[model samples]
Target: MLFRQLEYFVALARERHFARAAAACYVSQPALSEAIRKLEHELGVPLVRRGRTFEGLTPEGERLVLWARRILADRDALEHEVRALRTGLTGELRIGVIPAASATVTQLTDPFCTEHPLVRIRVETSLRSRDIVDRIRRFELDAGIIYADGVDTDGLTSTPLYQERHVLVAGSELLAGSTAAISWAEALDLRMCLLPKGMRGRQLIDDALATRGLVAAPQLESDSVATLLEHARTGRWACIVPRPWVSTLGPTAEVRVFDLVDPVVTAHIALVTTAAEPASVLTTALTGTARETDFATVDRRQR
Candidate 1:
């Protein structure tokens, strides 16, 4: 019933441990337990399936946790709005970013911070597109930078941020005789280090190769784009990455960057936020920032 009780319950659901949840809430174990008990009594439902150790939430608790998250999110948004009306935006804006788009997130965050100096920004850069979308839906992230293609956007608002074109990067020795552009099949033939199949970038690459009846059998697979690039730098493997990343994280020496051709693949990168009505103030501000951001400079440089 009380907001504090809801906080404790949500924390418990998240931590899945009574002691850790109590620690997170900065309250004693007994206090947290008593609050949840009171909340359960008020709702007339057994929220937790308990034993000596922490058991999982009951069915009713599982459903109510979703509502509890929404309520807490709404409460924070209300506080942010009221505080902003008097003192400018002053809360943290939590953003989840897909790793392929990690280098480019600063394009939005830098300006957002400059405009609202009091607002704090937290960027989680290692998420996949699906993970970012899931977190946004769960009210865990205010916005996300993710690949726009092949992701379920139902109940979400997406603003196109930029187009990402894949490029092949490898040590000079590995690409000693390669041309300015290489076909997907040729790239696949090299000793390659590629993102795992679960990543959106990898999926796009796989789809492109599938058109040629070819599959990427990389020498190594990693979830991190940086890791793939690192392996490429060793002269033993080649990796494919977004062309824009070449300007930022691409190696300056010992590497040859080739445009991926013979069916060049491009994916739309987008900023996504939940489609909930009465959008949070931070989400509105971030959406506006996304609209006004000038990616032309980066685009031109990448060209």
Candidate 2:
């Protein structure tokens, strides 16, 4: 019934582990468990299932969690609006950025902080694009930097910040040290490490490769771009990465971005927010700046 309880419930649902959820909410485990119990009693339905640890949500709990996000989002919006009137636009903005495009997350933040010095900005890097979309939908994220059209985004709106082209990168040994653009089929013949199969970006890569009637043999796989980049740096393997992201490695990190052949895959990177919710001023400004900002300038700083 209380907004605080809803926030707590949402956190527990996300963290799944009561102890960790309590830590995240800065409360003790018992207090969180008691609050959730009281909330269930008041609602006349359990919001979480019992187990040795948090196993999963029940059907009803899952449904309520969705509704809770909307209610809590509305409540937070009211508080943000009131505070904006009291002061200039100010509040915390949480954003999620996918790994490939994660470097661009700060582009919108610098200008935002300069203009609204009182605002706080928080960003979490997610390798999976769907995770970014899910967090944005749950109101856990104010906005996200994700692929332009990768997500269904039926209930959300986004503005393209830039177009990202895919690169088939290999070590000098793979391309004989010099650079050679590899076809999807040719790339498949080499050792490759890609984002985990479950990741949305991975799915995009798969679908693109499927068009060539080729499925890559991935001997090493990870959901972390940092790991993928690290492996590629050793020149022992190759990876498919987004363009512009290539320069993020250290100077010793020798790598090259090669254009894909025949069917080149390109996706627009966009700043996205839920259209169904009222956005905080910080969220609005971040979204606005992302679409208008010069990423070339910002990306240099990220490097």
Candidate 3:
């Protein structure tokens, strides 16, 4: 019945291993098991399928996990509200961002930090668009930045932040003085290092090329933008990247950027947050900043 027990159960459910869950909860295996046992006794229902090793949660445990997450989230929100009244916004804001939107995350984070200097910001860029939505639903993230297309937005509020314009990036040596835009068909003819097929950005590229009666066969596939950009920097391969990524690259002396033409495919990037009643204060601030961010102005300034 204790809050710690609920936390322990939630950790156990997520980790799916008694030892690992205990480690995550900063407790010993025996202590965690005892706590779960006490929780089950108090609730009068077996939450887990007990065995020598970690077994999946029981049907009841599945339901309890949802309730546990909401309870913990509500408790944190209450604390944040009280602290805000006394000390301004103070707490951690966890954001899950798709790699394509990685560079533009600062648009929201920077403003949020400036307004609420006490809040800590954490941006995780290793998630897919779907994974970002899933985390928001689970209350594991305050908000996320992801592509607006084909994402599950149920129970979430989405605000369009900017349009992602595709661009071709290559080593300056490879491109020489050629700065003209290239068609998708022309770009595919080069030795390309691109994001893997599993990523949404890669999928969009493939679909666009498919419409042009072409298939992308990348010379190298990577999930990391840095990795692809590094390959392009070697002067052996060209990569397609989003315009927002230019800001993150700092100085692009090694690579020349060209806008992609001949069927320009621009996708909208949105700030997504849970639409749960009484949204978290952090999510509110983030979405507000997203709404106010003038991407056109930011792009002009950055240029």
Candidate 4:
């Protein structure tokens, strides 16, 4: 089957809509449909479940999509390698980032961008670490910034970036007489906002609280760090956030920051990429940038 046909099939599987798939491929609906039909004929296996409207992929299609993605990724890597030899790296580098690392991802990307001026970078933030790992396996992301704890990195190359320290933040009024460090129990006693349980950051917090025989029953829960920080600024809620975020978001004068003690929780964050041999040129470059980068110093500078 031709690469164009594989591209159309993968787009159809991703979009799950014939019209949208065609739009994504920049082709007419009939052209995309015909391409997939030809691909099916070549493979001697039906790829799509046919209907008046778009139906999901067939079992064979589901199985073949994985191979299709790998083939396309390899093809793209070859093209990138050749292009880099002639004119330096020139393509989009897509990275998935967990919410906790959103503020500090610039430490890695900044240097990568400086060295590879022709390369464009796309950072997708607020992703769960598991989701980021899954996307990397599927070849959707060149690399990811994610928590290294409790995450399966069996087939991925993980390079430790930094330790993400948790901190308690609130308005000056809410913590009017608080010390430099607050216990987990004390932080939980106040009206609090926290990340939802599904996020890795929130899970870390939950685990830490569980050790102290305390459960977080925050009055407000959100996925956005900025939202939690904003609520903290209102002097109505205390939020636990990554210390690095305080530097990037810059807590206002009324906001107070305190270390989380009595079991200070820290999550190891890493840059993860697929462990496939002969790594893509962009992924190699990103891995190099990650190695040379030190986010702890960056955070210290920001502070």
Candidate 5:
């Protein structure tokens, strides 16, 4: 029943290992286990399945974890609000963002921090767009920057931030200059390296290519954008990336960036948050700044 016990339960559920969960909670293994036992006794339902080691949570535990997370989140929000009233807006604002939208988070934070310099910002990058939505729904993230397409927005609201235009980046061998734009078909024939098919960016590219009845056969598949760009720098392979991500690199003489045409597929990136009213002070600030700020103005100068 205690908040500390719920915290331990949630940590255990997340870690899926008792020792590691205890370590994360800064408590000994036995202490964490005993706390969970007490929690289960108070609730009159077994939260965890017993075994030799840390087994998975029961169905009831899974449901309880969700409620526990919401309770903790509300508790934190109350603290943040009271503290903000005493001083100013001051708390950690956690943002989950996909890899392509990672560089664009500063567009929201820069203006937000200027208004409330006391707030701390943390951005988790390279997440699947769907995962970002899930985490926000669970209150694990204050907000997220994700693609608007193909994401479940049932309990959430989105504010459009910017449009992501696909581009092809290649070394000198494949593309000699940055002057010309190439079709998705032309780009696919070359030796290419790209993100995995599971990523939102890759899915967008694949969907666009499918319209032309083509499939991607990458020379290399990587989760990191830096890796793809590194290969492209060698002038041996070409990669597809977002235009804004390319813009963050400024002038890249080692690589050529060409716009993708012949059905230019664009995805709108938005700031997504839970639709619950009376958002935490930090999220309110972020959502407010995102609404008023112009992405082009903030992003164009980011480089």
Candidate 6:
């Protein structure tokens, strides 16, 4: 059968309703049903249980669904490679990244564009890890930069890009009267600004603070770290942010980042791509730049 038939099968298998499946396939229900019937006849297998409504796929149908996903993915990859041969590194690379790691993507994108100028780059920022992986698998996004821990990447491959280092940032007023490091107990009293609870970074923060049986009282929550830093600079605010981002501050004359004492926390971020297909040339180069990026925090520590 053709790729369109397999596409129709996967859409039907997922929705289990003719109307919904057809809508997802961007066709009329009658059109989708005919295609499925054609596919079953060609394969000589009963693929779906039919009546007035779509019931479910048979055992053989379920197995074909799995194979269909693989075949479709490979088919798309082959088409992209062929197009690249004629066009030279042209197509689209859709990248999803954790909202906290959004800023770092700029570093990779610039160099990547230089290498594959013909490719179009799209970036989406999301706070959830599962959502990132889901988007990557469903063909919504070509790749994602996300936390590697506790994310199920069943058919995805990852290369560790950097270790996101954590640090304590506070209003200059708080730091002026205190030591170089801020202990957890001492930080409990300050007005904290953290990423919304949806982010994995916030979960890491909770994990770290749970040891002392203390949770932060966030007076403000934002997805953008730059905005959080601006709030700290302008108000009596304190935040625990990744150390690598400190360089973004033009000068921390009005703000101060202190070491979080006891056990310092770090999050490992990686570039993830679907394992089923060879990456398009643009995506491959983009992911490679991600792998080579120097999380500046590491170098500063080395010095």
lDDT of candidate 6 over 23-105, digit per residue (tens): 99899999999999999999999999988878899999988887888777666667768887897777778888887677677
lDDT of 2 by residue, 53-124 (tens): 888788888998999898988877788788888987777888888887775666678888888887888888
My TM-score estimates for the predictions, one after another, are 0.95, 0.79, 0.95, 0.96, 0.92, 0.76
Q: List the residue pairs that clash in candidate 3.
A: none
Q: Candidate 4, residues 1-303: lDDT per residue as tens digits?
A: 499999999999989999999999999999999999999999999999988998899999999999999999999899999999999999888999999999889889999999999999999998989999998888888899988988898999999999888899887887688788889988888899999988888988999999989999998999999899888888788899999888755636868889988798988999999888789999999999888887789557534
lDDT of each: 0.88, 0.78, 0.85, 0.90, 0.86, 0.80
Scored by Cα lDDT, where does model 5 land?
A: 0.86
**What does the lDDT read for residue 62 in candidate 1?**
96
Report the poorest 10 consecutive residues by lDDT, candidate 2.
294-303
Over all chains combined, what TM-score does candidate 2 have?
0.79
Best by lDDT: 4
List candidate 3 stretches off by more than 4 Å: 177-179, 301-303
Higher-ranked by lDDT: 3 or 4: 4
| Stretches of model 4 off by over 4 angstroms after superposition | none
lDDT of 5 by residue, 80-152 (tens): 9999999999989999988987767887888898999998989899898899999998888989998998788
Task: Give lDDT tens digits, candidate 3, residues 71-187.
Answer: 999889888988888988899999999998787777778887998899999999979989999988888888888899997798899998888877888877776756567788778
Candidate 4 worst ten-residue window by lDDT: 294-303
